[model samples]
Target: MHGPDSLVFKSDRPWPNARLRVGAIVGHATSDSVRLWLRTGGPGRFTLLLYDCGEAMGSSSVRAELRAALGRVPVSAEEAAEALAASRTVPFEVDGYADDTTRVLDLADLRPDTRYGYALHSEDDGGKVILGHNRLRSFRTPPGEDERRPFQVALFSCHMPYRVSGLFRKRTDVGDIDAWDFLAATLDRHRDDLDVVIAGGDQCYSDGVGTLDIWKLLNRSMRREGGELLPDERSMRSWYRDIYRGYWGFEGVRRVFDAYPTYMIWDDHEIGDGWGSHYLADDGPDDGLARVLPDLADRGLTRDDGRRLLRRMFRAACAVYREYQHSHNPPTDAGADPDADADADAERDATGADTDAQDVWDYSFTRGGAAFYVLDGRGHRDIERDGYRILGEPQFRRFEAWADALDPEETPFMFVVSAVPVLHARSALANADLAAPVRAAGIGDDLRDSWEHDLHDEERAALMEVLFRAARRGLRPLIVSGDVHCSAVFSLTDDDGHRVWQLTSSAVTYHVPRALGWALRFGAADDGETPEGYAFRRLALYTGTSYALIEVNPAAREAWFKLYGKQIVEEPGPDRGRRAVPLSHSVAKIRLS
Candidate 1:
């Protein structure tokens, strides 16, 4: 029941000065380095103390030590004090311009496959720690690249926090169990086994601009006489910040973020529902927000005015997104140096087909024997101005280079993350021509948001060709995705047996309606062939709130995937009304070799 303003301490030593409410989130991690994101009450200097548990400790022992450090177990005062006195101290500062309350601390030069407990404390002007009560959290560094370690990762997305109508104060969705609560419980039960957690997309929905009070005001303002007097960039930034803080402040969600080295990428909902998939002009038939607000023109808002407002909203969204999500992700080439190659970057931008590496949100990283490339599907999408592109030319070129440079002997496995599924069901309803009509009915943008849509055919072909080429070179390329509100597996196999797989798990917290579930199942029930003559088939489909666990055993050249969620029982039996039981179903097991 703890809110954003509440602080949970690891001990009850009664420290009156420990009043600052802070949130510690473990960000991207490597064998020797890890990033810690902290959100404090306000801007100030702080010291982070990291204590490494001895290498002799086993996984079970490490967990015990962490529990004892958190005051969950009985530990003598002598042991606790000794551990704290032997910690490594690092000082950092947070400032107002950078969103006063948040800062990211990068710690490097740590041992691989090591467990470490950490605590954050506020400091006085004299450089002395002032916080008396602190919360101790811990994370384990991944095994080094040279090590052949068997690791498991959890992947899921579409986290819609339980929302209440701001005007009515009532629930908007079904009430069962919180998905984050289930995920936190699962993490606790298998803490030692899970190495990383990937939140594929839709970490928080900005549908209707969010559920906060400011968002409600914005919604009402949109329906006013002009519908053009929207919140300024500053006001929009504060509202978006409130949305993130409110949504992620739940105890279970906080626990999951703090417990693991989690990575994330943005999808459409992170900006607005179907942000990049529709026409931008208000007068166009396929216009997105115009369709949502059909009377904008009648309300005295011109097409140009609407377009300007959309651009403003986009700017605000990107500003807040960088501060909350992208800051902790690995930096892009252009982002590393904004001034580097300015002339070249400007030349590329003039073509409307190029993007600076920094402007693009795409990033890649490696763990052990596998490499991951997270695509910025929404960030650079341009269906209208560019005549259709999911990943702009520059970002796609970067992806091609990454794939071409991979040495199969050293890294045989590659995971391509497209927040949206690349090979989902193919249906006529998803055609681009039907976008206007579909959107008029309130679901058009979603139908057009797929890789199979006609608008993205060329780009999808290019992406698939690169993956196929990688597979031909003996690299097992697997695409993992979310945002479909269902769990499914698909594969493309050529005559020579060069195969590529796609795994999708989504709606970690949001529920999929029954009719939509049936539609998804029916659409994915068939097999087809790509234009390149490669056979593609849907292997499995589960429509529910679920997450996928992938276990990679590099030594054996094998990987196994398991989807965990509640299974539906159709039979009218005694178990029909019984308590829901979470079950793990084997989805796929593939050989990297």
Candidate 2:
């Protein structure tokens, strides 16, 4: 493979020409179209050759015809050059300035419930040949809106990439396996298991370990009063892009993405820890993660200064999210072509003082007999003093409208995906006597980040009230989440007899700290008695890395939540060879009434 033109090589890393650094089918998947994302080692024109798998296989002389028509569709190194030259292609040109691009190709009036095969090719801008081509990749169009059949969804989140710029640290004494080994293994083992994949949050930790050095943490004297220990706008953007490139570069993770369409949202770590939790000057001082460089706030900036900085950082991070994650399953409000420009405009508008956390990542879509709602919990957080609203008023109003419009009788199952658990042990800690003492010590203010925080009682109750309204209307809500570094399921029922269930899985790669891990296990255990038919069931809790699979059988009115654990296992050898194992727990099946 030859390299891109000399000018093109200046910006991007050097790589064999035409070979992709990363590729995936992203953005919203409709009956007719899906977005394809690709990044090349160098500048080139990417072309896709699409073929209906069914039609090709149905031919009387499949082998002879395909060979004659497309010349054997070579996958081996020897035959690839010939096959690529003969391949019929659809061109997607990379700008001379950029090597990464996303092309949304129409499926040419594709049929529903059908599989299609696509081969990727690349060439120089002048139609000259380049390097190795992508082998045949295939994806199936989802069933039409009226169709009813069983389907599965894979839910996982919180990937802290290993040793990237030394941001995420691990012990070298023992085997420190990546949790994604389990995710990749699950995708390999359960090849046909899920139709779609949903990543809850913390996909990439931009301001993770390596970003904040000890010098920044200790030396407040030499810095600008209100300036944060953060990168400037340009550096911020570059960091976000690098984080995605490094994290998704893994072949194992890439394979799952290639096989399934993924939908994602961002958490606080996307920008900085506990983002959008700002304190007004009149509200006294900041605390915990909310307390940034206060001297920066004191440096003649307005009370909205923190929020302004947050919005700036968010704008940069949101750019990458729009390109890689939100593009796949954007909010219903975003128009058909949800490009980066549209997202930037929306981010600017949503970043106003009235808006708490800016950037809109909430979205909804339906499949089978169920409707799925992905909530942007991190983006819409109001000040703890401002009634501690978790999802700002605008987001709540949108959710209310969507929920009210749904016919619960027709769509019996309602699935809500929140980055943080809506029902969990956090609620149990609301009334616990820890706040005053903790705050007096000038620490632990980040506890208010949860939905169940005491300051957010009214906010939590309001959200519950709206969800209850949906439950009364006959929609059985199942809230799924993946933060907090632990996995569990809790049942919630109010006095009015409305019942909802919460399932949580977290830390696809990040390991919980020992102190927090012990406390979670000790306090959040499931009591045997289903008191008042409301119970907190500790299905499983591991400080180590894991993921979950949710399978729904629409015909049977049942769903199964399967959790898989990934860990380093010692092989039977004198050297004690170690390997990563992603083994699933016994399936916990539930019947929906």
Candidate 3:
């Protein structure tokens, strides 16, 4: 009867082939604790063992003992699964999830600034067996107050594995190169030097051009007639489960998550294409699917009905998001605290009574000397142009509260993760004559979801003002994002000399269209425009698939962005071979001061 907060290990059924699967992960490490996430093949009990990695402990001796122990033990399938549930000798124990699949363990009593060797084990009625015992891995906790150590973070986004399959036309131009192979090589080479991984957004392309399997699942879930249960709840749950299963299946994503602690946030693709950009207003003629399909505009469902159906679909999607993404982070119980604000409930009522749905993913955490403010920008947006709000009232207030509580002088670097690019090239497709019919039909608003859109000017200004205030207070604001499909570095300095950096790394496995990439880099008038009171610049740009590594040297008072790209190479011979080769010369480095 262990609750969600407490760790429990039980495996009702061992997966048929019991190959451990761990991916789609995010880990948050504090001074004294580390939260770990893992996904298994099937239901079963498992054990996690953590050992201190220090010079005093002879590494060779430890390895020899573990190997000998593993070789001596013999385990049957049922015994392996049952032994995991029955054994309670490990330092930390958790019963596998109901299906004995996924588990998030919050491990305590860990030393700060220390790297600990770790292992996963499966036990059953007959014996105890180690899982992936041969591969060595370790998790490093945050530094203590007196420790000052240079740490590195890996940031990347928009991982759509299906893009390389060429089953979809929009990304047909993508070369045969598989970016994941490059990522796997890069991470393996630099795994020891990396501290934590920050996955900006679009980890799974829930909605994208090439995701046929996802759409197939969704189609099966939806009721053909489109009723209250337009999407069967059971089918929606299975779809989300399969999404994670398929996404974590990638070896690149799996290798990183298995080795390091990752922190993640979601973007439009997590729910659907351009989620929150479409409001489905009940009083408007722009019903949900009708705008896209001309004939359906006046046929079956009314505007109110459409809104209801969309709400249900969104609820289902949010539920899955909460279970997989938000549950691992800091608790959002502040929203329910009565004493915090007497009128909080009233505020929530006026803003729209879905407070839980909107605020669960917005949270703040402190590690070492830096703080992370992760935003749920896509969850609560109100696309109506009248009074535009990208982050509805509740989440915005929560962000303000987190900012107000920060003591900038003590925390020199503040990391803010926004799934979508805050500073982006103005859309060339936003105001085209060919898209006018789509605009008048009420769905064109989705095209203008960026911060620079005229409709969202006020909101963008407000966001900038907050960052300016933070900058003035001595916080070097570094915003990391990934949704644009092209990686770039942009910065803005206000009249007060307050500076903020937007380092966007995107499409870890997909290519940006050559024409659109060129337009974003050169054709746009606002590519490097400076506003009235600020100095703006585009420091670097990369249109190919890549990831950004931000290394902060506190003592030196400097930070730099290292962007890496993958090159496709072909060997010419009778035994022709094609492989992804790391292009060392194309490395783009930009200094932040």
Candidate 4:
């Protein structure tokens, strides 16, 4: 089978000056449309040619035609041009200001359940195509919402890229790329079967304020007073841009992104270790900033200064996130306005103090018999506020409305993506005010980040009730999550026997220590009951670099979740090089009706 890597078009002509930094990533797709995201080396006009895989053509025949058009099977430039001209063409422009030339192009009016092969070409100022080598990326538009068909969705999260400087460091040692390679191979093997790929959270870790270079840069910019010397907006944006590029630029990772329609939501690590959960005041008891920089007090950093710094960081992080990640997501309530000014809509306050209704990141979509609601757990989170909400009031209300409106007859399976698991082992340590102790033990703000954390108990209960209500109404609710660096399946059952499942696939690249893995397993081992009398228990668990495939068979009225873990094996070849392969770790089937 030809993987995404083999689809690259080769030519004797010199490569164009304006090239792709990250490969074309297929994102958020509906039956009629799909979004494609790309980052170029510089600002330029580009045209994407999308060729349909004819209904009568088989997979082999389609590949043969693609190869012939690209000259691999002997075709002239004119013939290739003619073939490409027969396909649909979309023209777009990229600018330097938008996260260094990143753009998301939405292709509309596509045929449902159809496969399309697309090639991107740089265009001249006169609107002529600049012919050169480019990869042929493809994605299949989802089946119509009314259609009840079998489809699969891949879920995973918590991607931490390897760092050479921290080679011996425990964290760095476990940050391997093997999982991504395995994921690429897995997606390629099941290309036709898999429809959507959902990255639960922590796509890239901005841990410890990012890499050594970023740390040094931030440190150098910090003043003793932490007033005037805080890193400027440009510096912060540059640091985050570098982090995203470094983490997502891996060859295997790019291949998977290029091949599938992916959806993503950010976790705390996207901005900092525990962005919304930590105290912002320097003198505050649980101030994560003070703990990370123990000498901040001695350096004369005050509470106000810390607040200002954090605000600046948040603004920069959110701005860049919107450009890189949020651009491809389905339009939000506020973002759906076609007449809204793009620049004005992108701007958010430094503190995020106001509930900018326009800043809503949560979105929902339907495919076949399933409905997916991706909650923005990190964006509007307000642990320091009086309400201590996770999704904040505005987004929470939107979610509630979406849940309330779901029709079991139309969408039998509902998946709620929370990034952090909604149902995990209850953490006793998280209930207490042991922030100082936990920080001393190098856990950072993790304990506070949990849904079980005392601060978020109310919000967690509210979310659970909503899911339970959905289940009672006959919708099979499954909460998909990541960020704990472990994989597990948990089910919540109400008195009426209504069930909701939590499927967690995490640390797609990062490794989990044996002790940590065992601890997670043990904590989730015991069955327990929620405050509302709903019993919950761990169904299956796997601690490793892994991902989950949820296959929905609407005709069967059931879904099968198979967790695949990464296993390193030596290839049987002359070089005898080792490679990572995916091995089935666990499987569970849940009834849809």
Q: Write the per-residue lDDT of candidate 4 for residues 102-196, one digit (tens) a residue.
A: 77888999998888877665643333322223345678888887778899889989887554334554222224667787787777777776888
- Model 1: how far is 44 from its true place, Å? 2.2
RMSD of every candidate to native, in Å, equals 7.6, 7.1, 7.5, 7.4
Provide TM-scores for the models.
Answer: 0.80, 0.76, 0.78, 0.83
Specify the poorest-scoring 10-residue window by lDDT in model 3: 334-343
CA lDDT of 276 in candidate 3? Answer: 65
Mind giving the per-residue lDDT tens digits that candidate 1 earns over 320-373?
677677777776542222122323323333343323224868889988888889
> Residues 1-593, candidate 2, lDDT per residue (tens digit)?
11221112234432111223547654455555655554554555666666566555545576354444333333332233344343234666666422235444544466676666655555443332222232345667677766567777788887764432223442211113356666767765554435668888987665444332211221232222333423233334444565566556665566666656677777877766666554534555554223554455444444354444445456656666665666667444431122333234335534562221345678888776778888887665656436546777777778878887888656777888888786664533432464454445432335556665666777677677777778888788888888677777676766666777787777777632423323444456454323223434444555556677877776566777777676566988688887765555423444434
How does residue 119 of candidate 1 score in lDDT? 65
Candidate order by decreasing lDDT = 4, 1, 3, 2
- lDDT comparison, 1 vs 4, better candidate: 4
Question: Model 3, range 1-593, lDDT digits (tens) per residue?
Answer: 33221112323211112223553243777767777665544555666655666664347876665545543466543433232232222433345343336566787877776777655665544444454345545666767744446667788888764442334442322233356566656665665556667888887765444333444334333332522324433334445555655565655566666666678788877777666666465565455454422232344444444443444445445666655665566666422221222144224333444534535677777655567898877777767646636777667677777776777655677888888777754533332442454434443444466666666777777777777788888888888988877888888888767899989898787532423334444432323444335667677877778887888765555688888887677989999898767754347888888
Query: Best-fitting candidate, measured by TM-score?
Result: 4
Off by over 4 Å in 4: 1-20, 55-85, 124-134, 164-175, 208-216, 224-229, 292-301, 333-358, 427-444, 511-518, 568-579, 583-593
